[model samples]
Target: MDKSAMSDPQQPATVAILAYPEATASVVYGMYDLFMATGRDWGIVTSGEAGPSLLRPLVVAARAGPLLATNEVRIEAQASLQECSSADFVCVPDLNIPPGESLEGRFAEEVEWLRRCYAAGATLASACSGTLLLAEAGLLDGQEATVHWAYCDELRRRYPKVMVRAQRALVVSGEGQRLVMAGGGTSWLDLALFLIARSVGVDAAMQVARINLIDWHAIGQQPFARLARTRQVEDAIIAGCQTWIAEHYCEHSPVAAMVRLSGLAERSFKRRFQLATGMSPLDYVHRVRLEEAKQMLESGDDPIEAIANAVGYEDAGFFSRLFRRSVNLTPAQYRRRFGSMRRALNAGV
Candidate 1:
């Protein structure tokens, strides 16, 4: 387990992919296929001969046997925690558990195995909710990490010491940059490529990507995130205001109109709204407007200025700046990215 030996190109790095009942089958198998392809598949496709395998990927579970994963997919584990004592890298695939669900007694053995791997100089990596396991293991304390966007808030709430970057598609942190994570969805492809590049070589990783037609998620997760909806609150007045604002967000002085509709003094209305929704009335209005703008940009080919006006912003420059600040992408950029997706789907239909 010499760290220095890991740099040798001739040495195939051992990758232990953790599998459990909560694991997603696609992520587990996808990562396994990609890692197995790293140094060997490219040459086979090009010259009809396999090249040297650079990584050894093993599906490791608590018990070495067939297990049912999320969605009832059967996964055959190559080794158990007790059998796989150490590895050069440990990968935790996306878990199907809800973000807010308690992990109080879950993955106890897997977490302990991860801690042992880290202590043995193995790099730890996760995809999506799998970052929760790393956090639960106390491996990500005070370290910056990224998870599936929906889980980012929950991760922050559960582990205040861990810095969560919801916008990043991939993040590398921890001592010697040993911890790596990929954001939600299929960004696990990026995680696999990154580890291959780091362990084998960049050329090997690029070849694997080309062979698999895998593209890196360079745009990050901001554009894909659905704006958090304002949940209905116990306060009837604020709840009524929320329903009203959803329809009339494009109207000028909407917050003022809401205040009047609330039938309370403006000062009292604002205070009650904040207490109910956790944001000021004006901020809530902006969220509604931006969410509408996002939908229009994704579904239509309207000009940016026109979309801005439709969303209640007359000054296109101001709208663009605000959109960039809030969504991390300008209206035009968001359209270009998501609009094409819409069209592609429509064309197929």
Candidate 2:
């Protein structure tokens, strides 16, 4: 799959989408539809005539047969790993594997095939947890990548050589910039559009997006991330403090209050707190306060200053800056993005 051939208008780019039992059917079929529509749908929508097909998408699995995918959806593979030797693009859709589970002993054949495809000059793209396959195949080593926010920690833990950009919606890295990865949820739409724009043209990609009414996730994943609750630790003292702080996070000098409640020397308590929670006492407090602020922003109509004060920050400017750094959005922007949805749900209720 030469780059020139992919860019040529006369030849359609072949995209092989890898599928397995754990794969999500929606992402696999959604990308197939988008790629298949690239150059063909625009003409039909505008001029009442179908245009030339710019991309040929085929679902490639370990064996050519029907397999049940996540949520009990049946997916038919058009080709097997041995049959599909090479293509202009290789796409791995989201897999329904748990973030903390080991990927060892899984997708052995598919991983080997991906390595061969990359060696043959095929561009590799993954959506969401599908990036795990590329990482497991060692294609993402020493390259920047991103996955769904929940999987970011596990990706970094397993592949220390890969730089994890958890806040980005999309990342393009690796040799010749051929590896493309999308972040959580529907960001695969971004990945598909990027590949289309790169291979065919930006105009074709834009036309497809318009036809599908796909909204680009430009703000990235930070705004959508919820702070994961700290798991219960073996240290009873620290665990009790955690429970106390969750309710008293908006109080003055919450860390010092926790130290007083722990009944340990201040320095010893801070050391033990970090060891147990994997975060400094002050950082933990900020996380709790920010989590509360996010809830207020989503569920209420409070002003920024009022929300900041309620979240234990008297200085509204400092709160605003900290919120922007942590959540990648100001209070108003967070409200605008999530408040409407909250209101809509409330209205439905």
Candidate 3:
């Protein structure tokens, strides 16, 4: 075998951005541009002579043709699956879709191609709804995956075999580091930087990030996620208890109140709550209280202790710890990151 053909350290790595109809334009193009620039520019910076390229990126579709973006923008597929045959990395960009929309069998061939690529030793990745493709392909079975918080429930419902850690910004799983999933919004940017760092070098990824002015979001989705008042449980009684908790989470002894309202025996109510919400009644109550605390912390200048007290936490120290555990940020940190004291106070009722 030719030395250059074999995983040569000096040779460039090939990356394929899998484009499809209605895919998010930014993710597809951004992946190509970022990967290309990182490798090309890294060469420019290191040797000053544009040395051996570190990465080669191309857009691939089900076939060699033009694919449509969400806004009907046309993006040409530079290569087809057969044309590329394989890649060092494969990125499946988000397919922009509304809530409750089905991605069922939308890209069945592409999904199969992804499975093939993984089996052939290519690392597979996705952003936002693109994780749906991975899930449908069975690559995510019994693996930890993350997706847009809005679609987490649906993904879990549809693919019961996969564990959905919807609160994470990115999840890397599968055997031998073969799978990566990025959550919603501009997370494709994060994925791009991550891929560049992983395959190229961190210094090269940093160079590209500087050129793109990308402020990497190091945080997870917990801070931005609004926990569902009613989780996707089929039990109507449990759903009603969830609603009641949402309404009266700040009241003293809310869990006891919920149990009384549930009308089930104490043991039965506890069991059902856990089965439905994946949280004990007390944990559920604390979760709701902390969510309210977050709102107050973000929109008001009240002291942390005051906020805690208002949210039914008499022990401010304990509340701060709980907040940190749940939101992955202390109350103070969350306020600084997302609070708008002036905007909230100034907005007229």
Question: Which digits, one per residue and each the tens of the lDDT, describe model 1 over residues 138-249?
Answer: 9999999999888887788899999999889999999899999999789999999999999888999999999989989998887777655445568999999999888899
Per-residue error (Å), model 2, residue 107: 2.1
lDDT of 1: 0.89
Q: Flag clash pairs in model 2.
A: none
Q: Over 4 Å off in model 2, which ranges?
A: 1-9, 233-237, 260-277
Write out the backbone clash pairs for model 3.
none
Candidate 2: tens digits of C-alpha lDDT, residues 1-349: 3446655767788999999999989999999999999889999999999998889999999999899999999999999989888789999999798777888978899999999999988999999999999999999999999999878877888999999999999999999999999997799999999999998899999999999999998989878777654555789999999999888999999999999999999999999998886689999999889989999999988899999999899999999999999888888988998999899999998
TM-score of each: 0.91, 0.92, 0.83
lDDT of 3 by residue, 278-340 (tens): 679998888788878888987789999999998888999999999998888999999988886
Rank list by TM-score? 2, 1, 3
In order, the Cα lDDT scores of the candidates are: 0.89, 0.91, 0.83
Candidate that scores best on TM-score: 2
Once fitted onto the true fold, the runs of candidate 3 whose alpha carbons sit more than 4 angstroms away are 1-11, 41-53, 97-104, 152-167, 229-236, 274-278, 340-349
- The predictions' CA RMSDs to the true structure, in order, are 2.7, 2.4, 4.0
